[model samples]
Target: MEIKAKQLDSVNASAHIKIPSQELKNEVQNLAKKASKTLKIDGFRPGHVPVAVILKRYEKQLQNDAEQNLLKNALNNALKELKKDSKELVGEPYFEKFDKKDEEIDIEFILSFKPDLKLDDYEKYIPQYSEPKATKKEMDEKRKELLKTHASLEPIKGKRALKEGDFAKFDFEGFIDGKSFEGGKANDYVLEIGSKQFIPGFEEGMIGLKIGEEKDLNLSFPKEYPAQHLAGKEVVFKVKLHEIEELKIPELNEELLKKILPNEKEPNAELLEEKIEEQIKNEKLLKLVDEELKAKFADALIENYNFDLPKGIVEQETDMQFRSAWQNFSEEEKKELSQNREKAKEKRDSFKEEAQKSVKLTFIIDGLAKLRKIDINDQELIQAIYFEAYRNGINPKEHFENYKRQGALPAVKMALIEQKLFNDIFFFSKTNKKGEK
Candidate 1:
């Protein structure tokens, strides 16, 4: 066996692997025997078939299968040999080119892998962040929100009039030019006044209506309404109030606090305030650190390296993004999208540079992860998967399989590792700025 590597570019390597004719013949013969057992032929009794007859019947196929297996096995061996005796091997191996012109047979492959980064000052580039402190005002606001969550609603006595936050039932019919329009009529529909749950001015028009009251609601639909014909059209609604009930908000006290904050026995407003402030400060810190780290990481990687990414990967990613966008659009929106395909294509092309950078960053990160021996534990992976599943309202087991089928397992694993790496890096860093004392 002979192997030689040629550099196509920074990210691509072409290798020529030569297998001896004698070796190829031996491999083919051995493979034929392994395949002959279950292979049926018209007068053959399983493994008892003669090799000459078998060769005569299946030599061509056997040789093809042997060649394929040889390519895979030989490629693996060549990569190992190159890594050990020559330069380092990069990403996954691909069979770029091949030839059988000579009886000796030479196979060529183009492998895509990450390039090396000169990061002598990786630690120095990360921005030093000041530790955040929760504020009293912020904590008070959070406490108020908690109090509102515990607030109870009670019906107001006496028939004054339906107002905002009041539940009301009514019979209404809307008409345009004296003819009833679509979606303009309902009988005994219960609604909350000033809820903005209905068309423009519809809820506001219902406000201040006494029991058994009758009133006419006049309004025009917005120009962007979903119903094209009804959009920007004026309609009159004849509203008849049937009954009204006032909303009673509950007070935040001992009983309310107990129910709302089960973790804190004897919880008070001050304790709730502290918890709220702490939550806000933690959220702000995490958000700021995550954004900064991503930007810094990308900048660091890009600063040290520059190369042309494979068009295949970029096209694949773009197509995936395009499908995602399309899936989010409605049927009419899809038609509009189709009509503006050139614009969409232009938008996609504009993202090519970023996509290239992303690919490079991914390759480098993956390489660094391997070099650092970074591995995600089963528990962490499962937790991340479960969190995502819960957010998407899907069963974890089903979602995991779906993610794998969509070829997103690598992405999920990479995301989990990247998050862990950043968290570990930030957890112990000291701050020299802000409220640190």
Candidate 2:
């Protein structure tokens, strides 16, 4: 093992790591020896396979494992030689190159760590403002809306033509050029007139039709419709309006309270009002506090913590942003830009400033979290992911694994950490200042 490393700066380093052929071969053999004890293969008894057979049969996998093992070893040795603790490391060490030749393996790695930020007193950035309060009138309005959501659907008292916001019970049969299509007919389907649940033109076509009135709506399926065969094809739906309906809003009494808040020990108007007030207060607090004060404070902190960012990371961010913008360009635009090198450089250069700021803010946040001892553990992160998955109706394990595979788990964890850090800061400050005159 030979490692030649140089410090690029206080927080960045570069190294050339090497492992001779003999060591790699020895590692592969060791791996094969371990695999022989646990592997099961055809024509061989479990835990009794020969190491030679295992090496020959799983050569690619063994080679990969061996390389990974050596890389880890190289990292540990490099850390020791550099006099840098593993705890101070930041993002994954970037591999500049990994070359495997007949006699040896060569690797180039660029390592970085959290900079020693001399951040100023960030508390001064916290904006001073009167905390927002939920008014009684607002709570009363919200409560009325909540009770209306629990309202029952009832037949309309006065018969009238269908209109936007009205609900309709109708029967519809669809046809393509006089021939009926599969899944083209339904009976007694209840739909909100302007909900847009149906294809475009279908809901609008239902307007102005009275109960018992029948009308034929001619439409073309959108080009991107899910049904490939029907996409961009013309169809006509013969719809007959059967009933008109409206929401019969209920009184916020005991019966309605029980329906809305089942299992509540005290399902009364007072309890409902309290819950409503909490909801309104939270909404206002987010708008007034998080958006206004917290955002302003973050910008101020970024300006206050003036420090140099890692150049490699900043360039990487700029490149990523430029490539993303390129992907969104129209093909003609891409062609024009590709033909004009100077113009393309200008396009890419526009992203550099923002990219620098973004990279710098990330490091600033990282240092601030360390200084404040604000941290997010693996369990807390996974719980947040699980809650998001539940809300979006996805399997939590699958979502986690998907994020892990895409190498996006770090970004997600960072986002959670940022949210946690900001919330923790604003919360305590607000609590301490609660009794201020």
Candidate 3:
């Protein structure tokens, strides 16, 4: 087997592969011998047919199979040789032609390879981030929310009107145009007044209705309601209020504080303030770290390189992104997208350059991993797999093995590499926000 390559473009190259006649003959003879044992003929028993007749009968099919095998082998060998000479083959090589018209089979490949990149200087970085500081007001607010979460419900006093945050139980029946519709009646339904849980004006109409009070709820469904038949239709609900209750938040005493924060030496305002401030500080620190990392990573990428990206890779990425974006849209939104197809196309076309940059970044990162001997340990991989599976509600071990089996291991490898690279850059880079004191 021999391969000859010619430069077609910055991102694409054409290769002509040739398989020797001797190799083709050997493959045909081997396949014919294997078929002779099972092939049946009118005049001869199985395995007794002559090789020449077998060749004559199955020549076309055998030749096709042999040619496919030869092409695959030659492509693999050619790529391996190219990688040895130039280590920038970013993605898979695509085949353009494979022909076996005669003894010497001819094959052509349009390879999508990476180009050279020379990063510009990016040692100086100016970061931007918010510095959050918790005050006494913020702490008190959090404590108030905590008290509300642990609140107790109390029955309302006699002859009192309903109010917001008050729980009520009632029986009601709804009528539309003097006819009662299905799912229009309920008994002993529990509702929170002013929650707006029911249709527009339904909850507001329930407001001010006391125990054992009977009234009418006049409301109209929204125009864009889910039920097409009843949407925008006016309906009257005959209300009968049975019982009402009010919520009473508990006092923030030592006992309540102990229950919430166990093992605390002192459960008071000062202790609570310290805890809230610590939590806020940690949150701010994590957020700042993330923002800094992203800013630094993008700067590093912009500073380090420029290259002509593979058109096929960018097109593939754009299609993937379009599918993802389309899947997130509703049926009505899909129709809207159809109407504005040109606008959507414009957005995709704009993303092509960014996608190309991303592809080149991926290739460079992979190259860096090889150069620096960076790798993910088994424990780290197992933990990552566990986190992914737990988030998606799947069996961790099974998910990990499935990804490995499906040839998605490279994705995991790249993720690990990118994480490491980002961390390395963040630690080494001198970063400070513009307004930091």
- Scored by lDDT, the top model is 2
lDDT of 1 at 427: 54
RMSD of each: 7.6, 5.8, 7.5
Ranking by lDDT: 2, 3, 1
Clashes of 1: 5
* TM-scores for every predicted model: 0.62, 0.69, 0.61
lDDT tens digits by residue: candidate 3, 1-437: 88887666776766799887889989889888888888898899878888888899989999888777877677667667555344656566665576766677677776777665433233343344445677778777877877888898788888889888899999999899988888889999989887778888888888898899999988888999877888999999999999998889898787888987787877776787778787776566556667664656565664566666775576777766677677777898687668898877875676676677677777667655555467787788778888999998899989999998977777786788777755554444345333443
Ranking by TM-score: 2, 1, 3
Off by over 4 Å in 2: 16-73, 96-108, 116-120, 127-141, 179-184, 220-233, 252-278, 284-297, 307-323, 329-356, 366-400, 420-437
Question: What value of lDDT does candidate 3 attain over all alpha carbons?
Answer: 0.75
lDDT per residue for candidate 1 within 39-108, as digits (tens), equals: 7777878777767776778889878987878877776776575463224444445554566754688777
Candidate 2: tens digits of C-alpha lDDT, residues 1-437: 89998888877888898899899999999999999999999889999999999988999999999999999989888888889988988767888789998999989988776678765476666666666567878977897789778888888877678889888999999999899999989999999989899889999999999999999999998999888999999999999999999877787677888887888987988887778887786677667665676677667777777765665687678888999888789999899999999998898889999897888888877777877788889998899989999998899999999989988887898888888777677665554244322
What lDDT does each candidate get?
0.72, 0.84, 0.75
Supply the TM-score for candidate 1.
0.62
